[model samples]
Target: MKKAVFLDRDGVLNEVLTERVKFVNRPDDLYLLEGAAEAVAELTKAGFDVFIVTNQGGVGLGFMKERDLKKIHGRLEELILEKGGAIREAAYCPHKPKAGCECRKPNPGMLLDLARRHDIDLSASVMAGDHERDIEAGKKAGCKTVFIGEGETSADAKAPSLQAAVKDILQLLAD
Candidate 1:
């Protein structure tokens, strides 16, 4: 089985001054958060396959098209590669919140699917994001969880930024 790190895309990896933009609705609106690329690089270098698991309900709500979201992930991949880090793949739930989809955050579907497809060992993996649902998903998937940003959650660990959370994320492997 392989070790992996499942990361949330929007608030955790890339965003445009989160306070200003709630979501990246346009293909060209994506931007990597400060030190996010490096943080990811460190994880990949540490011998983990990285994957992006996100909830992109705007497509389901008609706010954006599926292709638009694809473009955003494409750009993100380009940017990360430029910084020497690469995401193995990205899987998003293009359904609206509470649409009863299994792939959405707070549910383990996405993580579970990826783990199955990639031969990943969930118990040896870590999931990090800026919301409680991300942690919840990790818990449901049997992976260690790291909470990013602020607010409240029962995450296994918490940090102010993805970069800052690197140590905490790695610690999960030790325990």
Candidate 2:
């Protein structure tokens, strides 16, 4: 079985549009956070299958077209690969927060599907995100969780940022 690392997209892989307090609806709005590419590369090089599990409710809300979302993801993948990182797959839920979607954060549907598709060992995998919902999803999916940021969380571990989180996860894998 393969070990995997699931990551949240917005605050984890890229900067959230805090200025607008909304999602990155346009491809131009997408921006990779500092050190995110390098951190992902390190994890890939360490033999963990890397995947992105995110909630993009903006689509369901009609704020953005699906093609625009694809463009953003394309740019993201290009940037990561250019930086020597590999993303095994990306999964997202387009349902509104109140739509009761199974694949949204705080729900394990996406992670569970990824595990099944990739033959992943949930026990050996890790989920890293910046929100409580991310941790909740990982916990429910039976994977170790790493919270990337401060404040109270139920994650198994916490790191100041994605770069630091990857470092800690690698250390745990070594142990």
Per-candidate TM equals 0.95, 0.95
Model 1, CA-based lDDT: 0.90
**How high is the lDDT of residue 65 in model 1?**
92
Candidate 1 TM-score, C-alpha based: 0.95
Model 1 residue 163 distance off true place after TM-score fit, in angstroms: 0.3
Clashes of 1: 0
lDDT of 1 by residue, 136-168 (tens): 999999999999988888998999999999999
Q: What is the C-alpha local distance difference test score of each model?
A: 0.90, 0.89
Give the total clashing residue pairs for model 2.
Answer: 0
Estimate candidate 2's RMSD in Å: 1.4
lDDT tens readout by residue for model 2, 1-175 = 8888999999998988577435688777888888999999999988888999999898999998888888888889889999999888889898888899789989999999999998998888899999999999999999888999899999888998899888778865555
